[model samples]
Target: MSLKRFLDRADESRRSLLVANRSSPDPILNVLEATFDDQPVRVSERAVPDVETDTVLLVEDGEVLATSPLSALRDTIVTVNSDLYRTGAMGIDDLDMPAVLERLDDVRFTLRGYPKSNTEKLLLVVVSRYIEGIAWQAGHGRHRASFQYLSRIKDERGTRRVYERLAETDVDVHVYGRPDWVPSERFDVTTHVGHDADFRDSWVVLFRPRPPTPDANAPDSPSTDHDPVALLAIETEPHVWEGFWTFDQSLVADLDAYVAREL
Candidate 1:
C-alpha cells in the first residue's frame, strides 16, 4: 500500500505528531515533503513536551555515544540503530538507555536499522530490504508463497541460505537477469540484454580472476576483500516510508524519471 493509505489508517486510530529535532535539509524532512505535503500532521522542532499522543516518531541519531542527554526523551523512546552496516553486529549497546528501554513494550517501536555509509545509499537499501523482509516473513509464516527480485540473481557470498530456503518452500522466484546463469527450475528468469547499455560501466570493479601463475608455488593473485556483512531489516513496515525520501527534490525527480523509464 502507499504511504498515504498507511497514514489514513493510523489517523483513524490516534493522533501523530512528526517531531523532527533537526532543521531543514534533513532526510526525515525530505520524507515529510515527499508523501505528506497535504497531510495535516503537526511538525515540531523540539523534544516532545508531552506523551499524550498514541504514536511518536522520534527521528534522530541513536546517540550511542551519549553525545546528547536523554532527559528530553523521558518516555516511550524509539530509536533506529544502523551501525550493522559498518560493524557486523547490531548496535545493541546503543539501546542502553535503561529507563527508556525498560518501557520498550510501552513504546510503539520499530527498528529498521542496518548500516549504509551515506543517506542516499541508506534510502535505497531501506526500500529494497523492506520488501525482501516482507517476503521472508511471509515465507516463515507460510503466508505468501513467493516474491520476485527485479535485479540480478547471483550466488554471492551470503545468500546461499536464502536460495535454499526458498527452494525448500517451493516459493516461486522470478528474476530479471542472465537466464543461463540461473536454472529455470530455480527461477523464472529473463535476460535483459542491451537494456540500459551504460549500466555495466557504473559497476565498481572489486576483483578479477586470473590464470594460475607459471610457477605452481607462486602466491595467489591480489584481490580486494570487503566486509562480509549482509543488510537485515529488523522490524520495518510500510508506514516507515511515510517518513523518508531523498534529501533533495532533484533526486526525487530523477528517481521519478528513472521509474517512468524502467518500471
Candidate 2:
C-alpha cells in the first residue's frame, strides 16, 4: 500500500483535550488550541473538578484515557520551536515527552513546514524524535527513516549526531532519500538512494523491535513486549503535509515490510 493510503487508513474517531481547573494563563491554552488547529483533536478549557487543577485530560468517547500536568504539557509541547530540533540544540536524550503527547498516536494531522508557519511542523518533528528515542532505548531494533534529501543528514548537526549514535548500536539503521550528499565513514547506516517521487515527497520514521526467539522458554530469549511504532507524512504541496503516527504492531510490521520490498 502507498504512504498516502496508509494515512487514509487511520481510524475515524476523534479525541478531545480538556484543560480542567486550569490556573495557567490564557496564552498557554491558546497555544495548545492553535497547535492542533487542523487536526481531528479538539482542545478546550473548563472549570470543573473532574481532574486536579492545572491538569490536561485526554478523552475519547467520554472516557479519560490519559492526563498530564498543565505545566508539563506547556514545557513539553507549547513552548517549543522547530529550531531546537533542526539546529541540534535539543538532543534525543533531552526529550522528556509527557504521556499525553504519546497518547496522540493514530490521530491524522496536517502541518506546514518552515516558511509557511513555525508551530504546525513542530508536532511532526517532536513525534519523529520520539520514535527515534524509542529506537535508541531499545538498541536492537531495525529502524528506517527518510529525509526528502540526503544532504539533511550531513547538514543538520543534530540529525547527523542522532544517526551516528544509532549506528554505534546493534540496530540495523536504514535511511532513504535523494543522494544529495554522501555519508561519511562514521555513519554506519545502510543508504538507499533514489530520485523517485516517493524519495522527494515523503517523511517516515519507523522502528520494529527485534524479533523474539521461537523458543520462549529459552533463557537468552528477548522479551516480545516492545511494540512497533511508525510515523508517516507525505507532502501534498510545497511546505504542506498530511500524516499520522501509530503504535499498532501489525501495521508497523506491514509498513516496515513494504519499505524493505519497495522504495
Report the number of the highest-TM-score candidate.
2
**Deviation from native of the Cα of residue 198 in model 1, angstroms:** 12
Model 2 misplaced stretches (Cα beyond 4 Å) = 214-222
Question: Per-residue alpha-carbon lDDT of model 1 for 132-161, expressed as tens digits?
Answer: 333343332111111122222344322333
Q: Across residues 9-54, which tens digit of lDDT does each residue of candidate 2 receive?
A: 6667899988999888899999989888877899998887556899
True-structure lDDT of candidate 2: 0.86
- What is candidate 1's CA lDDT for residue 245? 19
Candidate that scores best on lDDT:
2
Clashing pairs in 1: 85-115
Clashing pairs in 2: none
